[model samples]
Target: MTVRLRPTLAALPAYVPGKSVPGSIKLASNENSYGPLPHVLERIAAAAENVNRYPDTNSSELMDALAAKFGIGSDRLVVGCGSVSLCQQLVFATADEGDEVVFGWRSFEAYPIISAIAGATAVKVPLDGQTHDLRAMAAAVTDRTRLVFVCNPNNPTGTAVSGAALLRFLDEVPSDVLVVLDEAYHEFVTDPSVVDGTTLLERYPNVIVLRTFSKAYGLAGLRIGYGIAADPAITMAVRQTQVPFAVTQIAQVAALASLEPAAERQLAERVAEVTAERGRVTAELRNAGYQVPDSEANFVWLTNGPAEAGGIDATAFAAGCAERGLIVRAFADSGVRVTISNPAENDKFVSAAHELRA
Candidate 1:
């Protein structure tokens, strides 16, 4: 007899990471170009000495650090291998067959995948323009909805919804349903109107905030991220779903070192640089006649091409950039997301964009 697998796996699409071409400037993945500070590197190297021992599955020291940093009880936190892993854990913890998970259509690609893995239906609400239509999302929520993910500064688009609209949406959602604020790009957000997800935890007991060391903290390879759960029950559920000792000791040490005051100050300056480059890139794309969205994160979103180019779609634009030794992430029939790197790298992208437009 042939071996059988879960039938749902057939419909699930494999996640495609950004392409890497030798000698090309890759602006496809939304990663920090900077590396960890010298002190943090030293800690990570030192921690590597204890690799023979399994990591603290509870991650006690790291948990305490995060709890104190956010002024939250240790019981309300869960650290995962990465925020992406936590996303899956949240779905597994809450959803089951016949239940539903809701998120914006183009927000995070993994939302639907994770929901499907949990044997739950994925209910995607389309975006209004480049941003999430909160009213539409609120309307789409049914009694069967178990979790809702709001990816502020959405991926592949770089658009963020305002705080007021988010608050209204939260109020509309049923208190029993969990609303996840995926703030992987939190450090790069410069908008005052964009609500910090952590600030909403106390008032909204159903809220969970996911942040990462991958972006501004410059530890993408280390893969340490955390979730702030307003409810201890939710925290417990997410923690229970974690892979045993998935987080390594090196990752824990590097993350803790990154949280130190000196390291954080330096990282903040680096983030400021990225945001400034983001502004420059957005303006340059606009000047080249590309339809660019206002981005609060460390990247810019390019929609339809200039009218002069017969309104080319993202794929075509991405191909043009690739030919010019630049790699950017493109969504089929949607748009392109270009990461903001250092000034020189941003200039190369701008130059390529201008050439493509012309």
Candidate 2:
């Protein structure tokens, strides 16, 4: 007889990752088009020699580096496999069965999935325009709310909420609830008014700021990210839930190497290039008559669905781009998200979009 799994587990929606088609320019995932820096690669290579030994379970050196960089005490930080893993850990740490985890509907696909896995109820507030509706999210919180995720420069949409709006939302949230500011794409953010989650930690004891080495640091394959909290107890709870040896030795060393001045300068240059390309691509798409949102991240959003383009859905648009050796993320009937890469790659995607319109 088949073993019975929990009904919730059986029904959980699988996380859909961006497609990687061989020989195609993949603008589906918002990864830094540029790969890891030379120094980071060198450190990773050095770390490889010690593979026989298990990784430092605590990722002590990496944690120390992060603590120094953020000017926070080591006790207040928890490094994990990735920001996504920390998202799960947060849910497990605070939410129990029947408790609620609130977030924006299309913010991050992982929020709802992680909440469901933890047996917590998922409460998704709809976006205002293409950005987060912080007020609506604040209103959604009830006594049963244990956690909330606010994806700044939200994934797939690439729209960010103003710093003032976020502060207002924080003021309204209850002190007991844990609010996570998921800033996976923080490095790519160019907006001056966007809330830097780290800046608010001192003021909000319940706030947790999540950052990743995946995007701008170009270490997506290494799977290392961290969460910062003013409360050491909250960090402890997240640490307790993490899988042992989750952060690899190579990932730890590479992350440390990335903090070096030269490597940081190089990464900053790459970010500048991506940000410039983002503006160019957005302008081009707008000129092409698509309703593209103002993107602060390394991607652009096309919110007009099938009806906007004489009944051409996001899936069809994606498929057309695929035929032309370009891959972009499409959300069922909702919209399309295309990553801004180097100029040549962005040109290919732009050409694909123009062809699809024809």
Task: Encode model 1's per-residue lDDT on 232-304: one tens digit a residue.
Answer: 9999999888889999889999999999988889998999899988988888887878888899888888876
Q: lDDT tens string, model 2, 1-358?
A: 9998899987798999999989999998888878899878888999999999999999898888888888878999999998999999999999999999999978788988989999999998988878899999999999999999999989879999999999999999999999999999998888899878899998999999999999999999999899999999999999999888999999999989998888889989999999999999998887777888888888998875544653347888888999999999999757899988989999998888888777
* C-alpha TM-scores of all predictions: 0.98, 0.98
lDDT of 1 at 151: 94
Task: Report clash pairs, candidate 2.
Answer: none
User: For every candidate structure, what is the RMSD over all alpha carbons to the true structure, in angstroms?
Assistant: 1.3, 1.3
Which segments of model 2 are wrong by more than 4 Å? 306-312
